[model samples]
Target: MAGTSLAGWLLLAIYLPTIHGLRLAQMGTMSPNGGDDGVDFRPAYHITPPSNWMNDPNGLMERDGIFHVFFQFNPSAPIWGAPHWGHVASRDLAHWQRLPVALSPEETYDIDGVFSGSATVLPDGDPVIMYTGTSRRQELGFFWQVQALARPENGSDPLLQRWVKDPRNPVIEDAPPRGTNFQFRDPQTAWRQEVGEELGSLWLTTIGSQVSCVGAAPMYASRDFVKWEFFGYLHSQPGVVPSENETECTFGETQFGAEGRNWEVVCYFPKRVGEEVIHIFKYSDQIRGRTPFGRDWYVLSDVPLAFTNKTVPGQGNALTPSLRGAPFAPAIIDHGDIYASKFFNTSSGRLLWMGWSFETSTGCTGTCSDGTPLTDARGWQGLQTIPREVQVDLETGQLLMTPIGEVEALRSAQLFEQGGMKLVPGARRALPLKFPKGGSGGRQMDVSATFKLSDEASAEVSSTGFKVGVAVTHGRTGALTSVFLNGSLSAGGGGVEELEMWVDRSATGGATSANLQGGRVTLGGVAKEVTLRLLVDRSVVEAVGQGGRVRATSRVYPAGRGDWGLELFNEGAAGSVVAGVEAWEMEGAFVDDLW
Candidate 1:
């Protein structure tokens, strides 16, 4: 509303792909008041709402070659509040068309707000949405939440613009006795199974909640979209202290509340790995230790397809007890600011994963953790991480998530390329990529590099190890964000060292929520080679190591409008060689208003 005109706002009703496709460079000079505020923090290629607060990617689905992304949005302000479902659609993941609000507070049950939910395709091929509706229910004695349903008015519309709320909404009328109304929400996509011709098919989904003293993802069974029955939780975890030996799935003590107090955004899916079908269950634990904001934790269980459909809902199947003491344990997918993750199968029958990357900069009126007043000046709050192709590693029992190949379409020019460079201990050299000729210098890019330990380095098995990595720094202010490969070699001929993908943001100039985050990088056993891929979009930094065995999504604020700097550094007892480095300047996606 600042620099945007009435006509400019009205232009949203007209779809103009050509106008939005123009590079940000050719979009003409920007003003501080305009939508393109010339702010360095506005990500060029990432999916952000046209304006205001946004979080938790929701209602993800595909039909007719077009993909749709819905999110928790506050249409009025740059901060969170009573939410509406904001939407966008794209034929390809790289380009998006921003649409109007999908669902708003209309009925008395949802008058307060419309929260997070998912979209599932029905048997007949039409997609239906199930969401959480919130309002003060006098009978319930508190602000309550319940499940609701919505369907596209016209199934033929690929964009799915107009949605009609089901009249019998508050579909699952009340919360299960195990959880309070306030705690039960985020109904995930439903899956169907054929159970003999007599029973036909059964639809099953889960909702996040707390039951008794354990955090749980409670399952629900339904014959039709309108009626749902509570079945036992698919998984649950009792509160416990954090231990290095335990998986991230184990509920840990935090300042917010006791572990298992509550869980949010429960997601489930099945993928066949070789001959086994690994059922993947994921949830967002907002009260987990180390991450006061929240973290997405997942576990892979080898539940047979027959047992899953036959005894799951009927016997109230709970897989936690069996997985707790097993080697196949729960793990943190992306160890950073990402949370509330959800997945959907694409038109090509590929499982694609996405998560909400919330803002690290505080929006409060008072000073932030960094002593700054506020950082919501840009009129946006969150974004969706680049869609990742998901696959289960049969050998390691881990999930492999890599940026979808569709993202390559955004690559404009090759920014930098290098190969076979030796890196000695204590050696630090700058790269030419810091200050590129066009676009925001090093702000928007796709970079991938491979590092291999030299013969001498691989021979040493010291108690303490080496660290080698690429660093992104603000040339004017020296603000730094470093992603490193930390490990020590084994005594054997082939290095058997266990490597980790560690991200350090302690020196980043501006406000940030987390300083250090990392995960074990399973480099196919011996860890002879480490590959690091980075997708840098202004304030957001996503790093994938070992072909997505480990990932880190961080929000970094680098101070200065001057050139950026990229450097390679090595520290410790030995040296490593940079096998290869490839980088490309990415083009901004057109997320313009479309009716």
Candidate 2:
């Protein structure tokens, strides 16, 4: 789909608003399929997509003050096909401003893909989009799905530029009964159902289903947002992981419901405050595996369809599996490589999120890992995991996820600081907080630490207590990437002793692209102070324990250069670990005019 030559559409409407209001223009991170240079691992502020393939995080929305995001692109090549909606904006989600591809597949009911949906700002402020439109109905070769709508051809350029697609096309054509529009699609992000009295002012949504095989979401209402009305499956797949005696087994009662593992792209998140309201669902790709990894599950429900009064004898009100006990127990909120997306709303109700970090589809079949060759430069895959703010700890419901204090305004200084430091038993330690400000070595960082296990690491767990770790190396081809706090190997079986995380990049050879990327996380008992938080850019590290239950994202590619930075090991043979650490120096959210 690459044929725009009217002088490239009039220099793209004056270079897309002067490159979205260029805030200084050094324009970092620019590979877009060119000769590579590494540039210390890209991601200056995260939310990439100036080049090719992007997954989920579609139609996100915000208004007047501006914030749209929209994604799932593939504009002419990078990888996946069909996709289209890919826009960007920001009044200050930290200087982002890209906009151009907002919805494509250019017609005939979305010629092929315009997947993942959600985005709204109505109430009279104008801004509405609800997507999921495919189209390959050769009399039904299976791929028809509907639900479409778009707007903003002129809210007067809130940076919205041009949209407008509601020819009534497939505003909800069908697909839910036999369930094939490739398993329904993503929808969530349309709320407003409390003007009471018989669903007045209705406008609720929640697509993403699977019917007979479990995993569901199907529930719609709409009033003027383009006719809809499903009202059926509201929370199935209740078996919410339990098994070893704890009961709870619904993916149609096990074997992961005949190997489909269900669940995909489902979001719900209600969240309200000042009047208190919460709900929460969020989902995406679960089990049925040989490497099924891409989790983001959640449960805590009280609204948006969670165990909704059952009735699925022959699939009437759907949500089957004979619901009865264990009403809520999903939990997983993040195992990193987040997906789909959620946690939207705001105006004073603070809490923002945006996911989709996928890109581990190794059908690579020939040279990668810097040797190049997999074509379109691996089609510029995924990115966009650093837009958090998410809150809801109202007493440990845990989802605190912080990364948005405008990312500490992108740091810039504070280089290093320590406070307490201990490391008995076979010791080892390294340090070099942020370097590469101007002398140029690249690696951007923003670390924060606090690990304490002493008391001989909770009174001995045999040896290996002091393996407290942190390494992002290259000190001459030791080409590293480590993260360990071996609580007897990240909290193995014990009586109240959790909090575990161990990541080993096999010396920079780990994270085979799509990331099944390991880095265990136990976070259960063992607590004497455990707070690790890292964000190291230069091949993305991520890692956030203690504040977000437990996380550990991945992506590494060392390649070796000079001594490189960061190090602090602390092996053990005696036991005792205590740390304090703190680092800084980030700055670089790309395109300051393409440095």
Candidate 3:
């Protein structure tokens, strides 16, 4: 009778797929393409230029009412070699228009490729981009920072034309003492006006590794964006004493509260905590300042300052509006992998965020690869995560972030709905849903669920015990995020067991992974019940689980037909309960979109 019943249910499942507008025949079982192994996962929004290789969003700024986003791109293939600045612009920050390669490796100064940089509006109101120019000669690679001026020949067709690099290249060369690791690169420039000076000041931050350390970021001040002078080290790690390398990401204006009275210079650095990589902030009241000496200077214990914008005719200047002593304790922005984040001052009056998606490795290893190393083939490697919009909750004082809103307008085909359902163990449920009706577009989508586990189960596991599977067909192959208690479980031979909630991108062939561990908690509670939110775009999967306590993100590129479905797995034995499964389609929210 059980066998007959199971067969009947299988037949019903097939029929339900058709009724729900799903093409079951087209959807295949777990494979690289059918599962989470590729870069074309359905996304909440669609990227204008499909895919090859993209990384580190550079020069993210608004000019002439258009938001320009430049990225480290290699158009030759979907790998990470031969970097160039790929340009794209969007009016609404959702739908994007791909522009020509803004900056390439044509000049001897930038013969290798253009690395990462930032952009600011010049005093003349033209857009100025400062970037690191990397060159290679006789198997040796040297990086020199450069700046270029760009203007819209036609205000209406900013995306139609190309950005022109300055004729005088190598505006800033490697710091003197050619042997020192202090090759100035990754230029982050911003304009500020002094109290008594007629002309405003330009602040630039670059990464350098001296003889004592590997990579440390230093700051410089410039009267003009073109000519820059080294100010001092923004922040450095322990030198030789406990010897560790420190590399700083982008720096920006730190704002405090709605009044925006206090401002400070905020920059992020990756510090090694045990074996894991953690991101910490350094702030100061001195408007134009650098990192001090010793371990005390290593941590930002002092209060911070406030920054405000002062518009000067065509030029917009960000001045040190106000200052504060410093926080009694420095704050850590994220415990997981986040690097090179750009904070955008959007028209909507809210601060936005875009950062480089780093893997467990450091430096070039953080970049994605096609599994095979570059022996002699000129193929591309990794890409960066799409730009995300960040939100800070005033009540709890925690940061919440998601991709920008414009990406959410591209959803089609809605299939499953569970208003409220109590999930039970031993029994798995499959809901009928429809895949978006179109060619294999980018795989980007927003997935969220509110879960409640049994008290006994929670006590036993310390959390919940169940797996959330996506894009599963008849077989059990697909990506999954499993949540369970913290304690160890016995497998069979008395071995300890650990519950893992992660997104597997093996189907897409892009090896990206994310997960949550027990001991991790946000402000709310011990993550008793979690709202697992995932943004699946192309080859990238940004999964925020357990209220952001556990973030498992990876990129996958699969090679199969783009057909997907959702499933739930029960890791627990019989008599377990999995309750409250809710999934919602999400849209991007821009700073202006928030009231």
**Cα lDDT of model 1 by residue, 50-166, tens digit:** 666778899999877879999987666557766788888888888888876788876788877788999998868899999999886676555578899999999988788878899
Candidate 2 local accuracy as lDDT? 0.60
Candidate 2 lDDT, 1-595, residue by residue in tens: 4222322442353234233223213433233322122244445567766654667777676787777778886655556677777777777676676766767675766778778788778888888788888777776465566788888888877687678788776777675554545567777778766434555567777787665455667777778878886656655453454222222232232323433445667776666634556666666655443343446666654333332323331233322222123355555655545566666866766767767765442343211212223324333556777777776654444466677777777677777889678766666677755564473243667777776665444343443344566676754656677766554423332322433665566667422352334344545444556667778776667777665566666665555345356676667543456687887767766443211
Worst 10 residues of 2 by lDDT: 365-374
Model 3, residue 200: C-alpha shift (Å)? 8.5
Best by lDDT: 1
Q: What local lDDT does model 3 show for residue 590?
A: 22
Candidate 3, residue 235: CA error in Å? 2.0
User: How many clashes in each candidate?
Assistant: 0, 22, 67
Candidate 3 C-alpha error for residue 257, in Å? 39
**lDDT tens string, model 3, 251-276?**
22211111111112234433232444
TM-score of 1: 0.86
The parts of candidate 1 lying over 4 Å away from their true place are 1-38, 137-142, 194-200, 238-256, 305-327, 362-373, 434-438, 457-464, 591-595
lDDT of 1: 0.72
Which window of 10 residues has the lowest lDDT sum in candidate 1?
364-373
Q: What's the CA RMSD for each of the models?
A: 6.0, 19.6, 15.0
